[model samples]
Each structure stands twice: as structure tokens, then as C-alpha cells.
Target: YTLMSFLFKLMEEGYELDLTYVTERIIAVSFPQDCFEETYLRNLRDVTRMLKSKHTDNYLVINLSERKQELTKMNPKTLDTGWPDFHAPPLDKICSICKAIENWLNADPLHVVVIHCRVRRNLKPPSQQHV
Candidate 1:
């Protein structure tokens, strides 16, 4: 498994591969690490294919990372968001995240929600170090 796979396992059984199923209509995936134009586009294509197969049609992506600006510049289609690394999100952000998820899930039974964030290693500080 790649380092990214080690960080987030496929939560459900079946053909999802690297993607994790949080629910039948909700999936989780690692943020594609390659930001370079060519590779990132390829990665986006692959991810889009997988999501299409799973959701069949409608889907909403909720990205939870501080890298939103970079990602937005790369792909204008996505709705970008930010949450600080290694710390819990502030109450307002938490409510907004939950609200978004709830809204999407309630909008349609077949609508799939995909959430992405950087891997655990990037999300938290080294355990061996002291602040």
C-alpha cells in the first residue's frame, strides 16, 4: 500500500479500491498529492471516473483541508474549504461542515458525498517531538 493508503483504509468491502465508504452514499478519499498540472488532471480524471461509477450520477464533494486555495486554482469546479491541521475546527466551522453534509444527504437519496483531507501524517505534528 502507498503511504496515503496506510493513512486511510477502505472502510467498506467491494470495488471502491483506495476510496473509503463512510456510508452507502458517502465516501472518503485522500487528497491527491500531486499538484502539478498534468498529473493532477490525470488524478482528477481517475477520481471522477470512480465517483461516477459509485454514485451513478449525482455527487457533492466536501474538501476539508487548508490547501483549498491551491486546489481551487487547479480546479475551479470544486467548492473549497479549510480546517486547521492538528487542531479541532472551531465551532462555526464544525457546524458548517455538518450542515453541508446534512444538506447534501437530504437533497437526494442517490446523491453521494465525498470528503477529502490530507493524510494523517500531514494533519498532525510528529508524536516524537515536543512543542
Candidate 2:
């Protein structure tokens, strides 16, 4: 199912459970889209709150390591590891979404939110098979 659909389903079932001990685990199977927008972030925040209210552990772990590698292979210039040095209005929107996620993760120490991304590629032995 789509991520939003899954989230909606979780919400529907969460209301029936106790509001004090539900565990909400969020696993980001892929990287955030390049065009991440404010509306998407808002939806994320709402979902997090909904889950937390239902007594579920709220955690968002993003797995971007593999995606970065794939993107690099497609276009090295398009994938950047850190904030861009140039100031562009479009970048502000992206930064806001990133900061929102960061703030949410930092709100509570017990709140587990992991941002997983690989900074470097591992070198494989010359004998390794290439597919």
C-alpha cells in the first residue's frame, strides 16, 4: 500500500487502542523526494502526532544510502552531500523541511528518529561480481 494509505489505516485502528502504550514505528524505506514540499512535511507532522496520541512509539528512520548511490550513478552533479553553498530561494523550502524533521527528532530524547544516509561508498574487492 502507499505510505499515506498505510498511515490512514494506522490512524483508523489506533483510535480503538489504548492511548497510553501504542508503539509507532516509522521506517522510511526510501529517500525523501527531491521535490519535498511544505504540504508533505505538514502531513508527516500530523501523522506523527496522531501516532503519538494513540500511545504509539513515534519513530522516523530514513534510509537514503542506497538511493544516494543510485542517484550519483545517474548524475554526479545532482546529488550533494551537504547544504549548498549558493543561496537560492528554492533551497529555503528544502531546508525548512529538513529542519522540521530535525526538530521533531530532537523534541524528546526517548523519541527515536534516525536519519540514515551513507556519506561514502565502500570499495569492493576487484574479484567481486558486478551485475
RMSD in Å for all candidates:
7.0, 13.8
lDDT of 1 by residue, 1-131 (tens): 44244334333212222467777877786644433555444454556655655555577777787666544543344555666666677888878888888987898888778776654443336564564
TM-scores for every candidate against the unseen true structure: 0.64, 0.25
Q: All candidates' lDDT scores? A: 0.61, 0.41
Among these predicted structures, which one has the highest TM-score? 1
What is the C-alpha lDDT profile of model 2 across 1-131, one tens digit per residue?
44456566646744221112222322232223432445334434444454345424544443333344443332222223333222233666567657756776578755544343333225443455373
> Given candidate 2, what's the lDDT at residue 8?
65
Q: Which stretches of candidate 1 lie over 4 Å from their true place?
A: 1-18, 32-41, 69-77, 120-131
lDDT of 1: 0.61
Clashes of 2: 6
Poorest 10 consecutive residues of model 1 by lDDT? Answer: 8-17
